[model samples]
Target chain A: MNVKAMQKKWLELGVEVEETEYAKTGYDFSLTLPAEKVHALAEVMLADGFYLVFVTAVHALPAIEVVYQFALASSPRCRVMARTAVRADGTVPTISDIYQGANWHEREARDFYGVVFAGHPNLVPLILAEEDVDLKPLLKEEKNLKDISALRHLPAEAEPKEEKAPAAAKKEPAATDKKAAKPQASN
Target chain B: MNVDVIEDERQHQFVLNMGPQHPSTHGVLRVLLKMEGEYVLDPQPVLGYVHRCHEKIGEYKPARAFMPNTARMDYLGALIYNQGYAMLLERAAGIEVPRRAEYIRVITSELNRIQSHLLWYGAYLLDLGAFTPIMYAFDDREHILDTLEDICGSRLTYCYCRVGGVCKDIDDKFIERTRAFIERLRGRLPMYEKLVNGNIIVQKRMKSVGNYTPELCARYGVTGPLLRAAGVEYDLRKAEPYSVYSEFDFEVPTEQQGDAWAAFNVRYREIEQSLRIVEQALDKLPEGEVMEAKVPKKLRLPQGDYNCSVEAPRGELSYYLVSDGSDIPYRIKVRTPSYSNLSVVPEVCKGMMIADVVTSMGALDLVIPEIDR
Candidate 1:
């Protein structure tokens, strides 16, 4: 399949192809499709005789990139990678309807990154505990440090030190006289 | 007399829990079998007991670090997993290995193949209530392991193959030892045939039992000897040749029966072919730099997804890696052959006896850790 024909096919389906890069390896093209058109794009790929290799997600700084790889079984050498980025908040369409093999991979993705695939039949935890599920472990660590700093600012550290307390006891009378003299200044 | 009459009229179907501990179940696998007087009814396999979450660990480790970890998943065919991971990294990074390194890889892989088949042959016969064959198979396997261990550091989990090439080169003495072992194996093949292949009882138990058609084989993504037994000539070494397999001349053995007997025969013949491959690789061993140019201290692959498949003893083992041009992979998915091959057991074991279920499952070579991982 030529790039022009594939691009036309995607355009006909109302899927906007953001970019297409040719791979130096055996794979011909790498297509970046919109998030909404993932299911439709997968349907087209399957119809064009592509086998689902696997699905994976990458945690980019601001957004999460979900990549689905497929290849023609007869021509196993040629590969096509379709990527779509969803917000880090976790919202994307499911491709299980197109390829049954995506069932386990999607469940795994959901377990690790908290990516929610809409219309997935079974969305329960596959590899991790449901009760302890945390979407952001790194963010949790940052919040923990801020909580510790706030606790330290509560005037609890104003108490006298042990050696200073002994010295202050001897000078208590003089300190009181000085306080009385500097009352206006203290106020 | 009245009690006896009532007992005779009672229902006989009962449930039996086989393993999670049973020796026959192989590793931490548990099968819930519904039985009706020695015949099985709907054996539901309960997995996850041995799941170590290898993929999760691989996600954190660097691409090169995954070489050692690959062996732990399928301990029986550890070197093949090691080779598969190393080969994928080599291909992804476009590292060129020398001709001698390729030959050595072939030699070690073939030896690993023999060891795997011997273990499979022994264990399969043991499922049929024969114990002596396993001992015989182990005797031969021990020699192969000893030879491999001498060249590589470890015995079972051989972290031998590096990213670009082998970790160390094998001297002429190692090559001579391997050649002698091949000759010894050729002489012992007939002995194995006489011991188990020609046994009347073994034939009765294996022949015409647990037959899987070629169409079902492909539908379930079965490969290696099991697919070949069903008459699909789809060995990755031939179909998608890798690691100097194209230069070597050997046959991909196939059996038309597609039964337990056929699977057994195919594996038996494959051992011979593997031996032939090792001999050819040894004879035509080239001399050159074993390792490729030194890779970076901190290796990072380009942002891409790569899927590579290799022929393991059980079937086709595929590793799908998604790299984001980072030290750690974004995702690592292992499509283990045992997982797919074992999934079709319920479909095949529906009408078979309890004994036949064990036979069929064993013939499939259900490595529970590989499946559960």
Candidate 2:
């Protein structure tokens, strides 16, 4: 399978980024989406033979950024990061039913960041005790927020805007533009 | 001696707990076993016994300060963890690592893989009721550890890898000793084959004991030997080709049978392949500074996210770092391989004899600390 060609499909589906920042940063490809579309994206990725590497959440305050690392186990590596934001309800649709491996990763994300996966077979706390679930060990206070990219003395890439407060980066609902640009008969 | 009492006893279902207090389960792990007579119906793993707040520490400390802590996550394969975190920071920050530094990283990390496999072999045998092989395995492991001790000083949980390069250079003595150790172990390989692998008892016990198919591997997100044992030739060394791995020519050993026996053979063959990588690295050992120049004492990755993955001894050891433009990271997630490898227990270990559960778990070669972290 042509691993690189899959990005065009994702773009056609409307998850748009001009190109992955892998050469600039380390991630191969990053698709930032809302919680609702993530499960559908996972279904598409899984059908394409991509395996779920990890599911983790980065607390950027007000909202939590959930990152899913998926990789294809075929020739020509195609690694992509599927990210989405979640708020107070902390619920994202579960893909554990599709990929059995997501079962523990989703639980671990919940254990640390309290970003719950809706319809997860078992959403119990993992790697932490039951009482400590409310602590949400990974959430940092505002005063302690330090820009590690600056401290390390390295150049930073443009970050995707937090969904709750969006400004830069191409706006979503971008599928039609890419689709229209392609030959209409190809559909 | 009433027949009614016997009937009641026979029909009763029971639950057994294995080691939150520790033994046989590997590290401080606990398994909640549901059983019907002598057969296990389900095995639920309870983690967090050794959770040392690793992610919290990563966020609180500067990137360089957190180097030593990476070694703490997967103590058995500390160098791989060190390599993963260091590489993650380097990639995120666009730090250029020297060619020599990359070669050094590969050599040391491969050595770590062999040492890890040695212990896994011995421990697996021990789990299968053979105690003698461990003594023999450790005897060989001690030699490699001694050679590693000469370079980094610590025999285990090495804190030697830095962001752009290793913490220290490999001395001539360390190189000579490692070469000699490799030859010594190579000569001793057949003896191990005879003593452990060739033994009739081992073959009978391991073969067809716990079948994990390729489809099963995908569903469970199993990687490394477990995936390879099921005949999927996807070693990160070959597949992703990070660092200087692509430069090395080696075969990924795979097995058609997805059972404990296949895992045993794959891991054994992997040790030889690791030895080959060590040899190639030694021959091509370049002359240059070990540390990358202009690397600041403190490391702050740019305000973005980065992921670095290394094929650790057990499976993929991935580190994800999210920076908030501060000295401390916003979030740091350590994706240990054992967590996913061990998670398949409740599914596959179910409906097997309790003794076979031990066999299957041993085949997984899990380091409990890795899972807990």
Q: Per-model i-RMS in Å?
A: 11.6, 3.6
- Report model 2's TM-score to 2 decimal places: 0.90
TM-score of model 2, chain A? 0.73
What global local distance difference test value does model 1 have?
0.70
Q: In candidate 2, which residue ranges exceed 4 Å CA deviation?
A: A144-187, B1-11
Worst 10 residues of 2 chain B by lDDT: B1-10
Give the per-residue lDDT of model 1 (tens digit) for A1-187.
5546766887787654433222223234556665788899888876665556556665532345566766543322445666666533356788876665566557656665567787887766544445535532212122222111111111223442222222111211122231122101000
Give lDDT tens digits, candidate 2, residues B309-345: 7799988778888776556777788888888888888
Model 2 C-alpha lDDT versus the unseen true structure: 0.78
Count of backbone collisions within predicted model 2: 14
Model 2's chain B TM-score? Answer: 0.96
Error of 1 at A23 (Å): 9.4
lDDT of 1 by residue, B1-373 (tens): 0011121236787888988887677788877887666666667666667767787778777889888789988988988998888887776666777888888988998899899999988988887899999998998999899899999988898899998889899997788889888988899899999998999999888877777775555334456677788776667787667778999899989898888888999999999999999988888888888888787767766545566777898887878776655667666778787765765665677667777778878888778888767
- In candidate 2 the C-alpha lDDT for residue A179 amounts to 19
Error of 1 at B89 (Å): 1.4
Off by over 4 Å in 1: A1-187, B1-14, B36-38
The candidate maximizing lDDT is 2
